[model samples]
Target: MQINGAQMVIEALIAEGVDTVFGYPGGAIMNVYDEIYKQKDFKHILTRHEQAAVHAAEGYAKVSGKVGVAMITSGPGFTNAVTGLADAYMDSIPLVVISGQVPMSLIGTDAFQEIDAVGISRSCTKHNYLVTKAQDLPRVLKEAFHIAATGRPGPVHVDIPKDVTAEIAEFDYSIVLDLETYKPHVKGNPRQIKKVMEAIANAKRPLFYLGGGIINANAAYEVRDLVQKTGIPAVETFMARGVLSCDDQLLIGMLGMHGSYASNMAMSETDLVIGLGVRFDDRVTGKLSEFAKNASVIHVDIDPASISKLVNADYPIVGDVKNVVNEMLELIAGIESQKYKVWRETVQNFAKLHPLTYHEDTERLKPQWVIQRVGELLGDSANISTDVGQHQMWTGQFYPFTRPRQFISSGGLGTMGFGFPAAIGVKAATPEKISINFTGDGSILMNVQELMTAVGNKLPVINIILNNNYLGMVRQWQTLFYDKRHSETDLSVQPDFVKLAEAFGGIGYRVKTKEEFDSALKDAVEKNVVAFIEVIVHRMENVMPMVPAGGSLFNMMLLEKKGEK
Candidate 1:
């Protein structure tokens, strides 16, 4: 059967089981959009911007556990999505971004909207290609999806020249991909697995260090089982928030710079660290020398290079997190859960002594209270996305996340304009559940335009704006370290967020007190429209239990001293 490249592109998407695609059409990619117009098999969402398109795809992927697909034109269209590509790459989110290139004849001739899509995306994308021949679409599309969704999943780019989209070719549906250079090892070695189990069994203060890879591998159940069976006190990184429920007894809490005191202390004093699918990032490790200094590290990851990229592993198991954890479960009978009772008590003591605490006030609305209230109201019934900064930390601390893929944020890239658009994507993927975007005043403005996208598409996502009237996180650093010399972080001259929401054809509410907040939130829930609730919070309040950069995890600024400044 003969078909054009544009038709083949849509066909390939259908064959790959892609149900929804997020994108913005432009001059170079007009043909693909035209083909999209005729397709009924999949739905295409026209986001407000290309960046939103990519971020929405990321949110969709995070929740669906499927490869997210996005399309855009060459040059600025692809460039606009760079941040999202980098974010997806850092978080190991599988995505396929299709870009329309200039005609092959225009290569190196500086044609309109022409740029090196492959070159610019090479550093961020796991793999990329330039397709000039129409007949080559099948193999490239197949390989793109395969590479994007395989081990250590990441974004893949496929740039199809404009001429190729119009070129007629023999379209064969079945083509076996010959990917000799790309193969991911999925099973751990028996010897390494045995050694890891032995270390967990014998260590007096064993700690399970969880990361996002467990969620990526869909191994939350495996990890939870291993933790329960071994009775090891576990601590999660930011991206691993819901792998172990916030209420899980075996879980201490999130461990990192903004981590709970107990979680950080446990990481500091543990005798053994059983890291599953973790990257040992700087935010989590604090000072490398002082981090888990007394502990023997057992790192399990599918990517071999990530094993010792920062902290050297004593026992490195190269395999899928699910596969390795399942192997450990087979040997769980050999380990005794009673041996670590004392260690668990010590961790619990740390939690009691200096927990993730904040000062509560009656006259003013604290950011923590807002988050806690939302968690109490929704629990695991809602999907939450957040932009970077104080609000992101607050969500990590207070949200009662009980399921994998329930919490979405930019962990590695920490992109600011990620939350609202991502919430739109989340709502698109799971229309049955409520999607909420917890964003700060500064962070929300970065992509506030996406409210129009939500409104236009009729996605009743709830955008909870913790409007503190400052770049809250940066202000904290200034208060603590910069001698209160607050440079330009003050966002006092901000737009009326509620009015801004209405301008985008959405409902809005302004809450200055906790009492107002409750009613506003309830109203938003009942309205079930694209809504934004701007809750005015204390401007100077900060994320607590902070371990300053390069400081030991054990040393945290527990509480603000009254009248210290």
Candidate 2:
């Protein structure tokens, strides 16, 4: 079949099973947008900013476990996506970002809407390509999708020149992708699996540290089964919150900078740490020299570069998380479960002693209480997205998500203003399930215009704003480390969030108490409309269980008495 390059791109995407795309239109990309307008097979979300488009695609990918696709124009439009590209790069998300560029002939003449997008995105992407001819369009696109969705998946950039998109080409949608430089390892070595099994069986106090890779690889059940069969306690990273149910007996709480005290203690005392599908970021391994000093680490990751990069492991296996975990489970099929009653009891005692507590007053609303109630109302089936702030910390602490991909947030990048648009994407991808965005007043205001996108698409997403009247996370840092100097952290001029939602043709409610929260949530869920519920909280409230920056995990600041820091 023969078609224009623009039509070929859309057709190829359809064949690739991309049901939804988030994008913005401009001069250089008008041909692609025009092609998209003629098709109703796939959904396109119009975002106010290019960055929102990328983040929304990220949200969709995280929830659907598919390669997220986002399209944009040239120059500033392409540059606007850099932040999101970097975010996905650091988090290892599978994304295909298509950006328009100047025609091939005018490459270096400073043409209108011209920018070196490939060069700009090279460092931030897993791989990138610039299509110089129409004949290469289909192959380049196929390669881009393959690279983006392969092992250790991350963002990939395809810079399509305007001339290339307009050129007529012979499009064969069934061509096999044959890129030699892009092969991904999908299976674990049998010897490596046996080595890990032996280590697990020999260790008395073994712990499994799970991360987002489990969800990405759809191996949550396999991971859970291995832990149960081996009788090893597992702790999840923040992004891997829902890998194991909070009530699972073998599961400990999250581990990292703001993780539970018991989890940190367990990591400290473990004899073997099996890191499954997680990168050992600095936050997870505080003071790297002393992190898991007594443990023999077995690191399993799809990306070869991540192995032995930060924290050296005794054994490293490079393969898909699902395949690797399954192989290990098969190898250790008959291994008897070890009794670690003393070890489990010791951790349980620490958890009870240093339980996560928040002050509850009838006069004022607490963020933790609101998160707990929201989790209770939505149950475990709902998808939740969060912005970076105190609310993010509280949600991680309170929400009990047992299913994978139920919780989405910017963990590694810690990008603010990610919640609302992300919620819209999640709702778009999973229309049958209810999605909510937990945001702070400061973070919501960063991309509040996205409320229009939600209403325009009729995405019934609930937006919960934690109105603390300040930049909560920054203020907490200032209070704790900067000698109580307020600096410019206070956000006194707050927007009327309820009115803002109304302007966008969405429902809005202001909640200040438990009864108000119940009413607002009930109305939001019952009504088929985009809803915003602003929960007003104290300005001085902060997320507790904080380990000071650059400090050891043992030295934690427990916020008990006000003004006692």
Candidate 3:
């Protein structure tokens, strides 16, 4: 059958089992938008901006464990979505972004809304394509989805010219992709798996340092299986927050610069480090020379290049994390679990010494308390999202994630204005569960326009603004290292968030006390509507357990402010 490229795009998406698409319409992509309007097989979320569209796609992918699809127009529209591309690329989120381009005849003419998207996005995207021919659209679109969801997943950009979308072509969704060099290995070598099993058995103090790849590769079940069978203490990186449930006996808290005292201490003293899909990020590895000095690492990751790139692996197994960990489980049935009993007790003592704490005062509302209250109020019923800053760290510290993909945020890029749109997407993907975003006053305003999107779409995502009125993280650094010469971090003069939320046709609240916060939270969750709570917290609160840059994780300040408790 003959069909236009726009119709083929929709048909291919439906064939790929895509149920949702986040996008914005424009002149260059009007043909595709017209087809989207005519189709009823899937849903399209009209986000407020191009950036928010891609972010919503990310949120959808994170929770659904499926490839996210998004669409946008050319020129500035394409440029606007760059942040989301880079964020997904850094974090290995699978995304297929279809961006419209000027007609083929206008190439290199600097035509209206024309730019080299392939050039601009080459570095950030895992792969990209410029589709000028209608006959190739079927294979290119299929390939984009394949590449985006395959090994070391990242965003794949497909630039379709406006003229191509309007042209007629024979449609075929069953066309076999011809690329043979794109295979991704999924199974582990038996010998390497045996070596890892031996290391786990012979070690005295072994720890499992997990990363986002565990979640991306869908290896949570295998990892949890391995951890439970071996009785090894586990510490999750920020992106791998909920691999082990908070109540899991062997689970250590998140380990990084702002990790728990118990986790950092355990990492410093471990003898065998079983690294599962972790890149050993600088945040997790404070000082390279001092990080895990006493340990020999057995690293398992699908990306071969990531192995021994930063930290040399004593036993490197380059295969899918799930497959490798599953193979270990087969061999792990013969091992005993009593070796790390003393090490576990020592780590627990470290936690008892200085737990994740804030000055629990009755007068002022601390950011930690606000985040904790949210966790207490909406356990299991809601998933958490956050924009970057002190609030992001506070949520990471206070909120206990019990399942994978329950906590979504920009881990690598640390992008502000990510949470609100992400929550919108999460809500869109799963309307049965409430979506909550914990954002800072500084971060929320970056994409505040998304409030309209949420309200218009009837996707009720609660926004908890930790209203500190200053860029809290940077201010803490200035106070600690710069002799308190506060620079341009103060954000005291901003619009009333409550009024802003109300202006966007959503519910709003301003809470100054804990009692008020508790009341506001109860009302918001019960109302089940798009709401924003402007929590008037202490203006200068800091994230503790600070491992100063270039310093050892073993040494950290456990205070709200330096030299002051």
Candidate 4:
């Protein structure tokens, strides 16, 4: 068969099992968009902003465990995707971003709508290429997908010139991808695995610190099995939330800054810390010297750079998380479960003493209560996305995720306006499962135009807005650290979210009390159309158990009441 480069690109994407793509069409990419229209297999999501398209693709990839794909035009369209590419790079997300470039003949003549996308994205992407010839399209695409999805998983770019899309080529669907420059480490060394197993067996107080890599590698069951077999308690990072059931006896919840006191204490007191697929980010380690001072660290990761990039490890194994865990499991297959009864008892005692708790008032609907109720309603099946702010932290503290990839949020980037569009992407990827977006009043206003996209696509995602009438997180900081002088945090001038939803042709409800919240939630879940629920919460309320910026985890401000200072 023979086809143009644009058609060949779409065919290659279909062959790679890509069924959904988020993108915004523009002048330079009209040819590719036309090819997309001709194809019946792929579904395209039109976003209000090109940036949202990239973020939606990221959310899809995060939840589905697939390489997310996004398409855009040259110049401004390509520029808009830079932030998303950087975010994915920082978080190690798998993404294939295809951008339309100017014609090859106008390469150095400063053609209209022309910018070197490959050059611009090189710093942030895992790999990139400029497809000048039509014959190279299929092979380049296959290699791009391979590189983007394999080890360390990050964004990859393919810059397709407008003229190249129209060039005809012999499109043979059968072609092997051979890239000498690109190879990802997948297998762990047997010796290293044996050493880690021996350390695990000998340690009296061993802990497993899981990260997003486990989810990316689809090793959740293996992780759980290893923890159960060794009788070792496990804690997850913010990005790795829901890797294990929160109620599981061996699960110690999240650790590090803003984590539970018991979790932080457990990490600090451990004899050995087995970190799997997790980077020791500053948010997780706090003062590097003080982090797990008593523990001998064994780090396993696919990216060799991350092994000793932060806190030095006693043992470093570079390989895929699933492969490494499998190797370790094989090494310790028949070993009897060690007795950590004392360690378990100590952790449980701490948990009981400082359990996660919040006050509930019947007079007003609280964000924490709403999140808890939603968690109960959805059980362990629903996928939750959150925007950055007070609601984001509230969801982190309140929601109970029983599996990996069930909780998706912008932890590293802390990008506001990430929730609603992310929920749309999650719903698109998993159409049968219910998806919810927990958003703050300030965060929602950043990309509220995405509400129209949700309604247009008929994606029935429940958007829960925690209306605090101010930027809750910043206001709390101002109140605590800055003489209680609230400056520029007021959000009272914002439009009514309920009316906004109505104008976007979606169902809207406002809840003021607990009863109203419960009723509205129930109604929203049952409704077939996209729904938005705004819960008015008390003003000037702050999130407790806070470690001030650049402060040690041990030094926390436990504010119990208003005006505690």
Candidate 5:
């Protein structure tokens, strides 16, 4: 059967079982858009900006456990999507971006709306292709999907020329090519599994440190099962928020710079750290030499480079996290749980002695309380996302995620404008589930234009803005480290968020007190419309249990008791 390259693109998408595509159209990609218009097989989200399109796709991918697809024209359109590509690359999110390029004849001619799309995207994407031949489009498209979804997933780019899209091609979507060099190890070595089992059995104080790879590998259940069976305390990274239920007894809070006092303390004391699907990023391993100093690490990750790049692993298992963990579980099945009664007691005491506490005043709204309330209101139904700032940390601190991929944030890149657009994608992917964006006053404005995207699609996502009238995170750092020298951090000139939401055709509310917040939240939940609720929080309030940059994790600044060096 013969088909145009544009139609082949659609056929390839259908073959890949892609149900949704987030995109923005331009002259170079008009043919693809025209084919998209003719097709009823997939839902196309027309985002306000090219960046939002990618972010939206990320949100969809994060929750759906599927490779996200994004499409845009070449030149500025491709350039605008760069930040999102970098963000996805950093976080290892699987995304296949199809970009339309200028006609092949215009190559090196500096044609209008032409840029080196493949060259520019090479650094950020796992792999990229420039498809000049129409007949090769199907195989390249298939390869793009495979590359994006395999071996520590990341974005893959495919640049198609306009002339190619117009050319006819012999279409054969049924052919599945297996590239030998692209093989990913899915099983852990038996010897490595035995070593991990030995570590689990020998250690009196065992800890499980996790990251997004668990969720990406669909191994959250295995992680929970491993911890439950082995009786090891666990601390997750920001990207691995919901791997274990928040109320699980063995689960300590997140481990990082803004990690809970208990989690940091527990990490410092552990004798064996089972690092599953996590890279020991500097933020999590503050003052690397001192981080888990007492412990020997058994790092399991699909990416071999991540195993010892930052923190050296005693037992490095290079395979899929799910496979490695499940294999370890099988090996340790009949083994008795270690008698770590003293260790458990110590961990519990640490959790009790330095609990996550804020000045709980009913008069003024605290960001922590607002997040806690949202967590309570949404409960297991919560599918929350966040932009980078104080609010992001606050949600990380207070939001009790009970399921994997329920909490989505740009952990690696810490992109500011990610939440609102991501929330739109989440809503689109799972319309029955409730989606919310916990954003800051500063971060929300970065991609607030997506409010129209939500309204246009009727996605009915709720945006809860923690309005502090300042860049809260930077202000905290300035207050602590820089002698309170407030520079451009103060964001006093802000739009009335309520009116702004209304102008964008969404319901909005501004709440100053807990009573107002509760009411607004209830209204947002019941209304079933795209809504924005701005909760005014204190400007000076900071996320506690913060391990200052270059500071030891053992030495943290608690809100109740600030230790002086």
Candidate 6:
């Protein structure tokens, strides 16, 4: 039963049911990499960079609904993954990042490749530890996985010194995790659940605001049941997209800054706002004071600290999203049927009047048209990941997601280089799923080297590039508010993206016209290799229904001019 810490690490991963690991090996972590090489249980994906490794793990986690595991060396390797840690932290993704540290004896001797792994990752991780003793490997690794996948899940870091990996220890892969301070509240408080049920029963214009927590808690079915039983309208945030189908009668679409007009308007007019696993972030709330101002908020979250952290909740229920929703549904069963005929009519009118629309051009391909066609062709089955900016918004707005975890993107972090690498992770984890990265020209270049990673690993992912020759999102802001001073935003002298893809050992296509795009996209999808299709879209086509920073969601910039549409 005696094993080295490196073997303990692999054993712990196997015990935790971790089948895949995304990482780049380095000298410090070479022992763990050696141990990884000896095992066929865990599939180790060698990403091009440490950042992409973390992102690939994120993609795997998002799709597989499992705790993502990443391994890297100290110093630059750890630092490279900091962005990914922060991104996962911001979006509450469950991840366990194992970093190799220098020997314990060289702690303060300024050892080579030795930076404070726990110190650097402290802010970004939910919890972190530096393991010096070899015997403590099993316990720490077990706790790390538990913490990463537990309540209000986020990244957890475990720093293993190089010497510890060589030390022998009796490795018992037991599940006796006795961390007294780390218990998550999974059951809803009865009194708070009663209040939510009462509110649901009484309110004529009640609205449910769902967040990433719904998907994180795996409570989509409970949310659907609650919405169906109560007949209440629901709107999802960017992180919680696809909780309900776009065509669901009770659904109003995604809400917040770039939210649908109907969804925002409904939020503005509601009397009761049921916050389900949502943090009520600023981007989603726009002007805080004006956000659901007239509504009595009932916030339900597993993390009690999240309650009233931003917007004060009249009824704060601290429990798991699915558990709380299930309890509420059970409590409200057989209650008198509630109707919001007038409110529904008002919301429908809002939808009809201010529908999500964009200018279509026959001569030039618009971004909206491209996204719509992709949705039409692929349907809602493809695993869609996106880098932040115009393409991110377009995917969220246009894609009709019916299943949970169907659309993945950088939500809280708004990370630019997230899409392609994440698609690689998604494809790696779920090879059967058609994974695609819907990205923009500017965002794609951030970590385009990962194209080689995908091709090398034989992870056939499709990257659809919306080439607009400018930082489209920033240009939109400049055009509307900054008097068209498009300083430093022009990316006209960019590399040929088609050639860039081909250079990375992937199939590349340039499509300017709609017909060409359709043909090229179909061809790319059918190809059993990494493919990139660069679709030339108009630079001036802006993502519409914009809510300027700090502006009330009600007061949106619907169009450039009165008669423009």
Q: Give the winner by lDDT.
A: 1
Judging by lDDT, tell me the better candidate of 1 and 5: 1
Candidate 3 per-residue lDDT over residues 1-565, each given as its tens digit: 7999999999999999999999999989999999999989999989989999999999999988899999999998999999999989988999999999999999899999999999999999999999989999999999999999988899999999999999999999898888888888777778988988988898999999999999998888788888988888998898898888878888889888899888999999999999998999999999999999999999998888899999999999988998888788889865788877888898889888888788865667999998888778787778888999889988888897888888899999999999999988888887888899999888998899999899998999999998878988888899889999779988999997788989999999999998899999889888988999998888777798889988999999787533465
lDDT of each: 0.92, 0.87, 0.90, 0.86, 0.91, 0.89
Which runs of model 4 end up more than 4 angstroms from their true locations? 333-338, 559-565
Ranking by lDDT: 1, 5, 3, 6, 2, 4
Candidate 3 has its poorest 10 consecutive residues by lDDT at 556-565
Which wins on lDDT, candidate 4 or candidate 5?
A: 5
Summarize candidate 4's per-residue lDDT along 88-181 as a digit string, tens digits.
Answer: 8888889999999988998878888888888899998888899999998988898889889988899998999999999999887688777776
> Cα RMSD (Å) per model?
1.1, 1.5, 1.4, 1.8, 1.6, 1.2
- The TM-score values for the models, in the order shown, are 0.99, 0.97, 0.98, 0.96, 0.98, 0.98
Question: 65-146 in candidate 5: lDDT tens per residue?
Answer: 8999999999999999998999999999999999999999997899999999999999998889999999999899988998
Q: Which stretches of candidate 6 lie over 4 Å from their true place?
A: 334-338, 560-565
Model 2 agreement with the true structure over 1-565: per-residue lDDT tens digits: 7788899899989989989999999988889999999998899999888888999999999998899999999999999998889888888889999998888898889999888899899999999999887788888888888889888889999999888899998988689877776677879888988988888877878889999889888999999888888877888998898899878988888877788888888888889889999888888878777788899999998888889998898899989999999888788764567556667787788788887678786688988889898888887768999998899998898887878899989888888988887888899889998899999988998788888888888888898998988899999999888989989888888778899899999999998889989999998999969988999987788787876766666666775864444
Error of 6 at 430 (Å): 1.3
Question: Taking the tens digit of each residue's C-alpha lDDT, what string does model 6 give over 1-565?
Answer: 8999999999999999999899999978989999999999989989989999999999999887999999999889999999999999998999999999999999878889989888888999899999999999999999998999989999999999999999998999775989999899989899878877888778878898999999999998889888877777888998888888777898888888889899999999999999999999999999998999999999999899999998999999999998888788779864454466777788889999988878777678998888889888887658899999998998899888888889889999899999999999999888987888999999998999999899999998888999989999999889988999998899999898778888989999999998898998788788868988899998898887878899998988784554554
Least well predicted 10-residue stretch by lDDT in candidate 4 = 556-565
- Candidate 6 backbone overlaps, count: 0
Could you give candidate 1's per-residue lDDT for residues 459-555 as a string of tens digits? 9889999988899999999988999988899999989888988999999999988789989988888889999899989888888889999998889
- Name model 1 segments beyond 4 Å from true: 561-565
Please count the clashing residue pairs in each candidate, in the order shown: 0, 0, 0, 0, 0, 0
Better of 2 and 3 by TM-score: 3
